[model samples]
Target: MDAFAIQRQLTGIEPLNGSNYTTWRTSVDIMLGFLDYEFVLYEEKPAAITEESSEAVKLLYAKWTKANTIAIRLIRASIGETIRGDIPVFNTAKALQYYYLTQFMSTSYDGSGSVREHIYKICKLVNGLRE
Candidate 1:
């Protein structure tokens, strides 16, 4: 594929709801590949650079997705008052991944965490809000 087309396809360059599954999946593939490339870059930099970047990215994703869920829940909390409508994507797993990626991937582009630490830090950002 052409570089321009590939670039457009990878970072999830369009609105989610309007995209076809083929486009979305291809975009996701592109995104993951991009993330992997970033990780490689980090590995090539100063030794600690890779680890720190990885940690930041992973934790950021955890926090971001949880917060996204919280955000939607908050919106739902206002249902019948501030917002009203069946959220078309709420019940799907892919929706959750999209939430995680869209919110956190920019930060997590490097992938340095030990997994456990990322969870604790990011999940903590969700706070105690019920939504």
Candidate 2:
């Protein structure tokens, strides 16, 4: 599908309020991955281009910059205005992902649930952190 079509579909994802973070995050991750913008979550940003920069270095820098910019914009757009203000400004997609993980991932599991359920929740949280 074209970028515009994918983006239009992404608009269907509900904005993140504190309560819907998990579902919102999964939707955004899948959309970004489809757009090839998920790399900014894993790859370190390349050094800024200089006059003496090699073609390969320049290309890498451009690719990273484009992905980072798009990912940041998409993420900000997905956030609910009420909670968006609470998040500190982030320049990179990875930093934004870390902020969301730290803010949303609940580590404390109450003893009210079955052991299997608790384990499943723990595993899901771990997978989110890994991403």
Please write out the lDDT profile of model 1 over residues 11-117, one tens digit for every residue. 33442332133453344445434433322211222232344478776665554455444434432332332113323346322343444444444434246867775
| Candidate 2 residue spans exceeding 4 A from truth | 97-131
Best by TM-score: 2
Q: Indicate the TM-score of model 2.
A: 0.70
Candidate with best lDDT = 2
Q: Write the per-residue lDDT of candidate 2 for residues 2-121, one digit (tens) a residue.
A: 968886867888997655667888888888888888889888888889999999999989989989998888888888887667667788878855764774564566789898867755
How far residue 4's Cα lies from its native spot in candidate 2, in Å, is: 4.1
**Where does candidate 1 clash, by residue pair?**
54-111, 54-112, 54-113, 55-112, 55-113, 57-108
Cα deviation in Å at residue 39, candidate 1?
A: 24
